[model samples]
Target chain A: MDLYSKEVMKHFRKPQNVGKIKNADGIGKVGNLRCGDIMYLYIKVAKDKKGKEIINDIKFETYGCTVAIANTSLLTTMVKGKTIEEAMKIKKDDLVKKFGGVPFIKIHCSLLAVDALAEAIYDYFKKIGRPISKELEERHEAAEKIGEELKKHHGGLFKVEEELHKEYEK
Target chain B: MQKRIYPHTTTRTENQRYFNRERRFLFGVGVYLDYAATTPVDPRVLKRMMPYFSKKFGNTMSLHSFGQEAKADLEESREEVANFIGAKLEEIIFTGSATESNNLALKGIALARRSSSGGGRHIVISQIEHPCIMESAKWLESQGFEITRMAVDKFGRINPEDINKAIKKETILVSIIHASNEIGTIQPIVEIGKICKEKGVYFHTDSSQSLGKIPIDVNLMNIDLLTASSHKMYGPKGAGLLYIRKGTKIEPILHGGGQESGLRSSTVNVAAILGFAEACRISKKEIKKEAERLQKLRDKLIRGILTRVPNSHLNGHPKMRLPNNANFWFEFIEGESIIIQLDLLGVAGSTGSACSSIKLEPSHVLLAIGLKHEQAHGSLRLSLGKWTTEKEINYVLKVLPGIIKNLRKISPFKA
Candidate 1:
């Protein structure tokens, strides 16, 4: 009957790599004061002798709840050896699903963790002077699509209101 | 290291169970766990109240036949309430709530003494007294009356000696809550009353959390004044009783056409009063068995949480606490976060005092019991009541540990 799975609790109780990484290739910090949850992720990404983009190390310092902590910890593990593009595509729903399912009200906490992970990957990309990854581009396109939908829904009313107001003034 | 899978299968099922259970629990499909806030109106009480709202509906003060019948019902309710508390019938005064009754008992007594005897301008109250009494004491202080707030132990219980030492010749009244709404710690009002009586000072207790849940013998306890609400005891919300011992004069707070022997002057709420009386009668007959049943459930809840949840501790007195009360604090987890998760799981409980839940500040009662800010913030109160069942308690036990564990994982404060 308990809401959380034993595995979620296990990871939560003993989080892997829970501190900061020094001399990291990518350092990402994400937060907004109004949101009340924040995370700082430090990742070491480099090519191994095999010339593969292997994650040498990952650590995070997060200010959030068990879900947030577990989500961030799981995120670090999930993205450790993946190419930067793969890491950037990680979604909030993915993080929540990994935790078995967060309460709907607290799905935001998981989102905060996912957002931090993306920021860290972006920071890594910036440090290397690379253009935005395909994942980042996809994220931007998704946001634009949402904005376009909103505009299409509401763009016409403003012009009509302005014309009507001018006629009333006249 | 093996790549941690993007979709952890076991974790998904756990989260599913947690969220699904929480959802099922909240929509009344889950156990109705919150009983102390207010109980479902007993069917008998509803039956008793029905006549007053319909054919028998009349103003008690009116001289007509219909009015006389209504007046008779009101007087009978007054007598029933008085008898329940072992007080004289004339001493009982009706109010809108226990909060109002508390205000009348403290303010009326203080103002009356200040105006009449021109002495005894000091009042002593326990640190854990309901805000109704505590705030009234503060108001009295602003009016030049000295107030002494005695401290309680970590169990949220005041010692008799502390109360005795706090008392002085200038102390006009000593007001304490018979049972705390948060931790459910029952104070030794009898001992406090004895000390006040010995010192020739009036003693009042806010029994809002105790009446109908426990036996209260005002005469045996030497209680000069007592306050309780009908809603707390399975009656309607808009009715309450203030028992002022006969010959203990207090100035009326509300002045109008003389009613309640000029102590309180308001049109009677006939149906509610009748309901209140009926509730009292039912509680008087069933409280002992009800208390035992609730205690078993409360004990199960406490033991289950402590055993299953790491770093969880009980919040109130072990034995002296209310039979229906169980409060716990799980470290590193936010109480609201856990409550939300529990809500998803379908359990209905509270983080702290229902009255203080809106404010972000930790409960004052929790603070009084010596909980640090962080510990207080992690608190949850589970109060059992008439409808609480063994199955519900077991379900809560099964569900809560996983919620706490899942929440602990995401908590920034987790050690």
Candidate 2:
């Protein structure tokens, strides 16, 4: 069976935000070569009305299959110009629903995209010396642990997708 | 290959221009470069096979004129297949697939030796054998047989000395593949076969990938048993052959209906056997001319990709590999992503990346060749077939650069 959906292909064919921001405020990197995927997300933060920190621009560099690249592309389009809280509220399921649906096996690609964004936020908060939420901190802790696990075992049987899948979604 | 030029020296032009180009299906007949996986059955072979389904649909085991007619046809096909490999008519035993034949060759000899030989329960095989051979050896290991997996050089060539050193008083069998299915590196079977013959050990070679592409002679190469597949050579899928030398010590693995002289037992597939025989006939006739023609195209494809696309290295032996195969691993980019983007431009190829396999691991053959995990993930295999045209190869050379460039831009690893 084909692993790509028409909606997914549309985004993969032309990822909207496909470059890095020069002098970006925050950068998040996730996934690894062993997983056959790696993602680096860059975000530019600016203060808006109500003194809120909003994402002015977001872009990503991804080395993965069609679904993973498309997930990051759709995510950049969805969260642009939104407050940090609003971007964090956008779950992987919402992004997956936007694509009609992805193959169940490839659902982890969306999870990587979502976690990459969250990690970017975590980086931004740490950079500004602001306190991170307990929930986001816990998520980062699990994500970081898996990243360590990926280092020790080079080619795992189940791979990081199933492990990350069991740990948490975005 | 004697002079390894570190391929990191490359120049990147403005890749932004390619992203704006029109994305349309550019070719009418999509370029099929995955011939190593399987080939479309030859129309002539199919034509010959059509009548067997209904008109000549008689069981070879039946006791009637219809049965005798089929039985005669079956023997004729077997004779043709045997002659193609330079074997006696009775030496060829048809099975369902190459995997089955491999299972039979490994287990049959191991089990036979276990029961007959005095406490000899050891076997030796190369590390780069197909999954069937590897798994069969693993199964035997679990059943109290000691197996030694011989390693290869960087070019995936096995040394005969390793085979000689691996042999022992208890070593009963040695199995190796004639050519690799993944990287297409041909082995020194004649040397290894001679080594086995000198030691009085049984030598079996899996020729599934090399039967039609190259020459094979069982007696001349000192091969005691060999395996060949049909679907890999433009024939039907359900037919494969195992050529066992007349005096080889072996026993049957499949005991049913006592077919194929009691070695392999099942109702014969008349149509597929006929098609296999015909395919082998055509391959024997055109092997020389087809190999030369393909070598020219293969060289062109390899040179064009290496010089045109920077940071790419050939996987197998530069000259000793198959004439129809060209494997490469580009720096910084993964293989499946490159395949997907190439498929978008109307080219079908395969890769060793984990994303493309059900087992979710990069090719073990690549790992055995001592490539880094990241390097192995970035491999692509483009194998040619009978219908592969010069124009199709040029199209691949034209489209592959942009795909690699785009994927590299997305990748974190830099060249």
Candidate 3:
């Protein structure tokens, strides 16, 4: 029996955004050879008269399995009309839940796609010369706090964490 | 919410099916689950092999300087394979394939015994022996040597007691596969080896599928003779090894120019041997990581298939099977149809053994494990590999059930 719904296969087979946008407002490329999965996301954002951010177009090219493709496709559809803040808040677990829950092993693939989305949003803000949002900064701080707690619990979790914490504090 | 896009609508029409099929369908980057059949050749192994094919290309048998260099590389490869399998460098004999290795081990040993002792002419092999060992035993019977076939249990594993009971004073050699290729059931080789040792009989194991996937300590297992194919371990095809433990006498199968220590005669396939050695080395380094990842993917795929497909049953041992192996029998669908459908969706895998896919017969391995002919005929094997990713597994998880449902609709068999 298959674990994914028919909708997931359809999205995977014919992924929505499969090419790059030249001069894309926000471009995010993530993944590494060690992970055996890679993804590049491109987004063009436009702000309305009221200064509400809107994603005008989105595209992605992912070299990953079906879940990666499906999740990327789902991410494109999920963020096309949303504001920048909404897209930034999209989580890996939420994307997986959108597909009726991806298989356990492939949950990482969904996470990769979501990471690409977040990176793309961050790139958009950097390109627009706007300060990083207070909300995003708070989220980053919370994540660092959790990471610090984990390090303290583990004692010598990773020396690299100390460096990252110093950067965040600055 | 939009309605799900079922895979059923993508079926080829009766008239236009052959013309419009997608040629290179990909399953995306999902967890690869099919490692038992074959593995992607490691890049490091390929890197080590590139020089021999182009710059260092020379016949190992030639007496020229280039030939001597080639010959040195060949011998080094032999040593690496020997060290990997826990055998002496001189004990390793390169063969064209594990099938060839098994034939040589059985026929070579049998011929040697007939010529030397003239009395120990009987041979014993497990009922679950790979076709190579089984067919060789049959050929030995045709040559007037008696052959004994040992029985296996429901999980396709032979009991050591059965081997002990089957042995006789006339038993010249006992050949068994280290692991069952189809079911991924690893045999108790140590116990069988001990039995053969106590009886003073030669024990040979066809380790073609198990060498790179599992830990193989020939000295610890007491295996007197073992066979391995490079292709099964992510190396090039047409290269294999036969580990003949020192002092196990075997007549030469190919006699010419005294190559492979006068056992098998042929100019060494230096490039393939080097590649095989590299594959073995890389496997030794990464086996722990690969096995763990493959096991996780195998479990997820198995769970997804079992939970989604009603009345589907797993064919092999639940936990005792290989980490990269998962074989399932769908109640009403044929294995071939599912494989073809999966191929159409861009997923590449085998139904049973790729070698036996053309035979149209139910897998003998499945039958030996008490599966009815129908269940045996409908078995699908998805062996994971190192290149497999979580993306591939999820794609399979999503696409396979729809394919099965469509096939079941048209199948004549009842669940």
Best by DockQ: 2
For model 3 the local lDDT of residue B100 reads 89
Q: What ranges in model 2 sit over 4 Å off?
A: A32-34, A145-170, B1-28
Choose 2 or 3, whichever is better by TM-score.
2
| lDDT, residue B34, model 3 | 53
What CAPRI grade goes to candidate 2? acceptable
**For this target, which candidate reaches the highest lDDT against the unseen true structure?**
2
Decoy 1 TM-score against native: 0.72
For candidate 2, lDDT tens digit of each residue in B42-70?
76688889999999999999999898899
**How does chain A of every candidate compare to the true chain A by TM-score?**
0.71, 0.83, 0.74
Per-residue lDDT tens digits for candidate 2, residues A27-77, read 777774345677778999998988999999998988677787889999999
lDDT of each: 0.76, 0.84, 0.74
Q: What is the interface RMSD of each candidate, in Å?
A: 16.4, 7.1, 21.0
In candidate 2, position A136 carries an lDDT of: 86
TM-score between candidate 3 chain A and the true chain A? 0.74
TM-score, one value per model: 0.72, 0.90, 0.65
State which docking tier applies to candidate 1.
Answer: incorrect
